[model samples]
Each structure stands twice: as C-alpha cells, then as structure tokens.
Target: MAISGVSIFVVGIALLVSVPLSQQNEEVHLKFSYSGETGPDKWGSLKPEFSTCSTGKLQSPVNIVTKDVIYNPKLQPLNRDYRTSNSTLINHGYSIGLFYGSDKVGVMIHDGKNYTLKQVHWHSPSEHTINGIRYPLELHQVHIADDGSISVVGVLYNYGAPDLLLLQIKSKLDELAKEACGEDEIAKIPIGHMGTKYLRRGAFKYYRYVGSLTTPPCTQNVTWTIIAKVREVSKEQIEALTAPLEGSCKSNSRPVQALYGRKIELYNAMPNKI
Candidate 1:
C-alpha cells in the first residue's frame, strides 16, 4: 500500500507538470507593453526561455530613408481572392493586430504548385524598414506554400486619399475584434479589387529580409517583403486605430532596433510603363 501511494503521487505530479507545458508549446493570448513584466523591457525576461527576444540581433522595426535607386517594376505580386474569417484582437504587445484569414501564399499549378493565403495582420507606424526607412502603417499578408515555407508580402501605408477598402473595413473593426473569427463568417468582410490592387501596385521599393514577427513566439525563418510606397489614411483613421481599449491606452508598434549588420538589397531596375 505504501509503495502504491508513492507511485500514485508521482503520477499526479507528472500530469500536473505536463499539462502546462503542453499549453505553452502552443500559442497563447498575450498583451502588449513597453515597460515592465508585460512591457517591452520584459519581453526577453518573462521567462528564462524567451531570451531570443532580448539577444537575437536581427530584430525588426527598423528605420527607412529612401535611397536614390530604381526597382524591377515588372515583378508584380500575384492576385487571388484572400479569404478571411472572424478575427481575434491582439492589443497587449507590439501594435494592435486583428488576426484572421486562412490560406497561404505560393504558386498554384493545376498540375504544378499552389500557394494558399494563411493569415493577415497589421502594425501601426509600420514594422518594416525599406532601404532603412520606416512608414506609418504596414500590413502583412502572410501566406504558406504547399510545402510549409512562409512568404510575407508587406503593404506600407501613408497619408493620402482615403483607401476605399479601409473605408469599408474600418467601420466593422471594433466589432470584428471582439473575438477570434471562425471560418464560416470570414466572408463577412470582403477584400475587393481596390484592396487587391493596392497590394499589387503599392510600391516596389521593398526590402527582402530574413526576420521574425516583431511580437512574441518571435518565430524566425520568415521571408519578409516590405513595399516602399505608402497609401494614405485620414488622421481620423489613425486616431481610431490608436485609441485605447476598454482598459488600456498604448501605441502598438514595436520599438525600432539597430540594423545589427544585416545587408539590405534593392531590386535596382525601372518600373514598367502601364
């Protein structure tokens, strides 16, 4: 009886430990910050485990100052219907991100290869650096290939004429953010031609870099393509985006970091005449 009791106690402790570890192995909802335990300062310190947050030198969110160079205007992004579902709002870390959509980006060959669009999200004041300069807002359209490799096309935003797509989605943002969206309701917010064209024609002054999400899980091995031309959003749009939640008031961009010896390449060519 004594031996059996000891064995049962050990098994109970083992189950307790494994449960939390399994959960941590997967993504969890996290809040954003710039200061303490929940702040940017603690991103790398929350656990002895998250050291990559502090020590990885190739961090993102860099500055961009356009260089006098041309790019391959011929390389236009492919167009396809990006399906989105319900989305979840992430406001605790980085900037505000409303994650939804399911598909990955890649080439689809009827008998060859196809890429599916996976998830889409955004960063305020932008998170990508073009030739070393940053912009106002950057939207990341992340896709996955059939083989599981990841490719991200980043769209930069600036102040200009109001984007019709923004006009369409802006009104529903507060509501869409109420919870993580499911597949059935994804079509409620349609990504139309204007949105598609914006992704294709925005700017070719992009930088192809190897980096991680500016947020936690800090997943590396991501291919980043950041567009240079920015589309405009009204001040009202910016204000609406940056407004505090029911319990907090904070800007959602990740702090810019040093280049740390990364090489930035530009496709020095000319834009094709349309």
Candidate 2:
C-alpha cells in the first residue's frame, strides 16, 4: 500500500539532528511516568529523541469531534485475519501488554497493504476521546507493515457487561498486577480465539487518520483507525485491569494532542448521511 510519508526511522534520525554530540552519546536514563517530574509534559526535555512528543504536528490521541469528520466512501472496511497464537503478558512499568510470537502472523489489510499484528496493549481511562467523552478503557492492537510502517486499531470500552474477549485474559491481568510489576511475565493465555471473535463483530465502523504513537519516541508514521463503536466491559473487569497497576502506573494515558488541521475520515459499512 502507498503510505504517505517518510519511513519512521528516517523521521527519528531527522529529529535527532537537533541534539548535541555529547548529549546524544550520553547514556540518558530517563524514566517517563503518567505524572510528576517525568510526566508527558517533560517528555521532550527528558530525552533528545523524544522531542517530537512536544513538537510534532501529527501527534495522536486527539479528541475526535464527529462534527469535524468527513464521511469517506472510498475508505475501505478493515479486513482482518487473525489466528489464535501463543501470547505473553508483560508489565512494562507503564502499561500491561499482551504479545504475540513473531512467527505466528495475523494481518490487517488497510489502504491496500497488509500490516501484521505485533502486540496488544491497554490504556486505562483511554487516550482517544470521542466528542470530548473518554471511555473507561481503550484497547490498542498494534500492527506493522513489512516496510516498518505502523497502523493501530483502537477499540474503546465503556462500563456495562463484561467483554468475553477481555474475560479470557482477566485472570492473567490480576496475576500480572499483583506479581508482575516491572517484569515481562508471560501469562499462559491463549488469545487467538478471543481476538478473532472480537475483531469480527459486525456493526462496527472506524475513523481513520495519520497520527503518532501515544508514547515517547512518539513516532508519527502511524495510520490510526479508531473504531467508532464502543464496546462494553463491566466495572469489575475495569478494576481487574487497573488495580494491579494502581500504585506505580495508576493512569498510563497521554493527554489529547492538537489536531493541526489533519483530516479524519469516518468509514461506514452502510451508506448514510453524515
């Protein structure tokens, strides 16, 4: 598929030019947190490489206003082919993540290119908001194209009945929260079935844009598709996911960044007036 910009690696290098040789070579151990001295506000100053976090025009997790979206008939429906695979859960000091094996590939076709599923991660209280409304939880399925381009499919969750797919990993989440802080503990969770079922559900639509990663080294090569449909997850499930990371990582979401006049496209399966 024809992605619209320079490779992310190139962008990183371009941004790094502003750093001095001494600071560039110095082993800077900057710890980024949800709040405090090392919070998002200080990310750009923390590390020379993360300058984009403070200055990039295409930063992500914007407050998506429906009134600003353009209904695009040309935007194709997401074509996902995910298989059940052996997955591992990790507590990365900031957020919890479920990783898939490199060999076990699942692909999502967007803009005519296949981006392979890499890992899934969560942000409590969500990062992206719809009409200034933040959901209780947000699930990000991170994918990468063969050429190193990134595409993330974001699903938002509200409080209601528990999601079956989330339930499949609930126990693992609890264990990781209590025992796996700052460790890459692999939970023996089979995620293929749950992931497939969740992605294949009908009546879902998405808003597409080109934005940056929510975290530091906030690369701006992402093709973001935020699912317009909000799913349900019980309050208990929300607690199960957040309780463990309470003290050290209470909230790992970034604040909404400026949109900078970037156009967001809403893709609907059925034709409807905007």
Candidate 3:
C-alpha cells in the first residue's frame, strides 16, 4: 500500500460520499470536458467567460512537492465543526454530488474566517499529487463564506476498508445515477442525514494554499486545505461513486497546472509527529 499523501474518497452501492464545485455550475460545464476539443487545454477558448482558464495567474490542482514546502508555525490547525445532517445525493450530468439541504451541516475555521460546509464531491485518480504520486480517489468538501468566497477541504484516498457512510447510500446513489443522467438538479434524492465522522476523525498533517476551483471559470483565490490522513475506501465503493456521471466526469480530473511560484504551507495537527 502507498503511504505519504492520501485521504478518503468514499462511494458505494453499499456507504457514504459523491462529486465537485465545478458540477454546481452546470451551465459552464455544459460546454467543457476532460478531453478532446473542450478539454483543459482549450477551456478558455470555449467561451468568453472561461478566459480565466487560460489567463489566470493563480490556478489550482498544483502538485504539492514536499521538499519545497515551507512549514508555517503561524498557521493554525483547521477548526472544523461538523455533524450528521439531513443530506441528499444528486447527479449533476457531468458529476455526482452529496449536498446538505435546509439544515446546517456545520463549518470550518481557518485564519479566523468561518465557512459553512456545503457539499462533498469526489474526483477520481486524485487531483493534487504529492511528490508526483496521485492516489485512486479524492474528496473535496466545499464550504462557502458569507461573502461567497469558497474554501475546500480535500481528502486524498488509497484502498482500504469500506466506508460506512458510503455503504448507507449505495442504493440511492445507484438509483440516481441510473435515472439522473444529463439532468441538473440539487439534492432531489434524499438519503437522510449523514455523519461527519470522516471529517473529524484522527489527527493528520494538512497542506494549505491559495488556489482556484479545479473546474471551470477556473476561479482563483479559493482556499484549499488537503488533509494528509489517507482514508480507507474499497474498489467496490469507487465504482458506486462514478456510475452516475457521463463524459469528462467519467474520469474527471484536470491535468496539474504550473505552480507559478506559489508557496505551499504545511500544517500538522500533531506537531512533529508526521
């Protein structure tokens, strides 16, 4: 089994979790994909608004080089306040997403700013690599601040035991994927309340940086926190997550972009232990 950088990307016909922030803007994605003419390289030319895809100085999904990382003693551990809340898993045509509705799922505090946890989405083959290693799956917990700035908590995963949360939602996920292809809807498939155990469990090293959404508009200034604790997920679980989406989403993950001299900061919840 590979170690180093990994986090939980949960899925199932059996437990918990599903899809990305980019899926939220179905309009923009309707014109883009992971390959071919509308691929990452041509995202900017697809539309006038997508110019940032080619022009932005600060982009996301950069490979995190450990040796080049600077430890920031001043950086604080991510303060997460989460819980089991009423949730729904939906298909976004190009992606599948697990979203919280009506109820407050919770929030996380970084640099004294509080962002509400909105939804959790998965990206296969992991987006942000560590030491040039890309894991099997990645989960991005999207949070939005009052001013609408986005902060994402990323979980990279390697194979292990099945996640219970995914096991609980497997049937609903399958049902939606089978019926919801090419539809843009929010939380229509209620899977009841889900736990926040994965987010709160254990102590791990996390990397912090300023970047953009991995998806289009390719919006910058998004804060990214990638937890270094790799979580367990089974192969069966992986298939359950991807069964719904079509096209670029089938193997959705943008190619790693250049760092452009951006500084990557490392934070350890248990100092000096990792």
Scored by TM-score, the top model is 3
Lowest lDDT 10-mer window, candidate 1? 1-10
Q: TM-score for each prediction?
A: 0.65, 0.83, 0.85
- Whole-model lDDT per candidate: 0.48, 0.72, 0.72
Residues 1-274 of candidate 3 have per-residue lDDT tens digits of: 1111211111221011112433443222235667788788998897786688899978889899888888888888777899899887765544567778757788888888888888887888788999999888888888887667788888888899987767878888767755634333322487787778776665458888898887766878888888877787888888888776665568878888888889999887666664
Regions of candidate 1 where Cα sits further than 4 Å from its true position: 1-27, 65-115, 129-134, 174-197, 244-249, 268-274
lDDT of 1 by residue, 224-257 (tens): 5665556677666665556522222244556766
Q: How far does residue 124 in candidate 1 sit from its true spot (Å)?
A: 2.1
Candidate with best lDDT: 3
C-alpha lDDT (0 to 100) for residue 240 of candidate 3: 81
RMSD of each: 10.7, 8.3, 8.1
Model 2 misplaced stretches (Cα beyond 4 Å): 1-30, 180-195, 246-248
Clashing pairs in 2: 84-192
